[model samples]
Target: MPEPIPSFAALGSHPLHPMLIHFPVAALLGLVASDLGYVLSGDPFWARAGLWLAGVGAFGGWLASGLGLIDLIAVRRIRCLMTAWCHAVLAMMMLSLASLNWLQRYLAAEPILPWGLYLSLLTALLILLTAWLGSRLVYEHAVGVEAKE
Candidate 1:
C-alpha cells in the first residue's frame, strides 16, 4: 500500500478538502437562487450578484481542487481511485461552467441573458453531483481520512 499524505495538507488532522469546500459549494449553489431571483423578478441586481458569485465560486473551486489533487495523489492506491477521478473531472467541469457563466454575464450588453441563466442552473446541478461524489470519497471510501488506530 502507498503511504499516506503528509499532515501539512490537513488542518490539525482534519482534511483541508472539507474545510475549503464550503465557499465554492455555497457560492455556486447560491448562484442558482440568485439566477432564479433574476428570472422571477427581472431584477438586474440578481444577475450582477450571480456574476460575482460565479467568479468567486470558480476561483474557490480551483483552490479546493488543488488541495484535492494532493489527496488524490495520496489515495491513488485505493480501490476508489476511479471515483476520485470522476470527482476531479466533474469538479473541473463545474468550474469551467461557472467561469463561462461569469464571462457571458460580463461580456453581455443586456442586464440578464437567458442562456447565461440557464447555464447557471445547469451548473448548479453539476455542483450537486460533484459534491455528492466528494462526500462519497470521504465517507464511503475514506480517501483523505486517516485510518483509526
Candidate 2:
C-alpha cells in the first residue's frame, strides 16, 4: 500500500483544514434554509439570519481553504494529485460565490429574493461538489491520513 500523505497544515497531529471545514459547510448550507424561511414567512428575521450566516460561511470557508492551500502547496504528494487540484479549484469557485452572496446581502437593503436565493443555491451546490472532491482526497488518496507505526 502507498504511504499516507500527511497534512502539512496540521496542528500537532490533527489536520486543520478538515477540523475547520464543518462550520462553513453548516453555515453556508443553512443560508439556503434561512432564505427559504424568509420566503415562506416573510419575516425580516430570516433575512437577517441569512446575512449573518453568509458572512460567517464566507469568512470561515476562506480560513479553512487557506490551511488547505498551504497543505496543497507545501506537500508534493498532495500537489501531484488531480483530485487535489480539482478540489482546490472547486473550493475557490465556491468561496467566490459565497463571498458574492455575502456582499450582495451586505450592500443591498432590499429583499433577498430571487438573486440572493439563486446565489445561495449555487454556492451550496458548489460547496457540495468541492466537499465531495475533498472527501475523495482524504478517503481515496489518504491525503491527510497518518499511518500507524
Candidate 3:
C-alpha cells in the first residue's frame, strides 16, 4: 500500500493559516496606523510608508489567501466555501486597491489619494472580518483543521 499523505495539522496553526499571515495583517494595520500618523502629524514619510505597506500587504495577502484557499479546499467543508469566498473577494479587493495605490504612487511618488484613506480603512475592516470568518471556518466549523468528533 502507498504511504498515507501528510496532513497540515501536523505542522500546527501558524503555518496552517495563522502563521505567514502577519505580513498582510501587519501591512494592512500599518497602513491604517501610518495613515493616522500622516493625518495627525502631516509627515509625508509616514504617509509614504503607509501606502508602501498597503502594497506590501496586498502582495502578502494574495499569498496568504492562496494558501488559505488551498487548505480550505483540501480539508473540504461547506462553511469553508463561504469563508473562502468572503476572504477571496475581499482579498481581491485589497489587492486591487493596493495595486492602484502603488501604481498611482509609482507614477508620481505621491501619497495615497485622499479618498484612498477611506478605501484603505474599509479594506482593512473587511480583511479583519474575513479573518474572523476564517477563524469560524476553521475553529468553529472544522474546515481547514482536522475533522472533529
The numbered model that scores best in TM-score is: 2
Q: Candidate 3: which pairs clash?
A: 14-19
Model 2 lDDT per residue over 1-149, tens place? 46799999998878999999999999999999999999999999999999999999999999999999999999999999999999999999999989999999999986488889999999999988999998899888988898988
Ranking by TM-score: 2, 1, 3
Candidate 2 TM-score over all chains jointly: 0.97
> Candidate 1 residues 88-135, lDDT tens each?
899888889888887888888863567777778888899889989877
Task: State the lDDT of candidate 3 residue by residue for 15-61, as single tens digits.
Answer: 44566677888887778888788778887898678768877887787
Q: What overall lDDT goes with each candidate model? A: 0.78, 0.93, 0.65
Better of 1 and 3 by TM-score: 1
**In model 3, which regions exceed 4 Å deviation?**
1-15, 78-80, 146-149
Q: Positional deviation of 107 in candidate 1, in angstroms? A: 1.6
- Candidate 2 clash pair list: none
Per-prediction TM-score, please?
Answer: 0.86, 0.97, 0.74
Arranged by lDDT with the best first, the candidates are 2, 1, 3
Enumerate clash totals for all models, in the order shown. 0, 0, 1
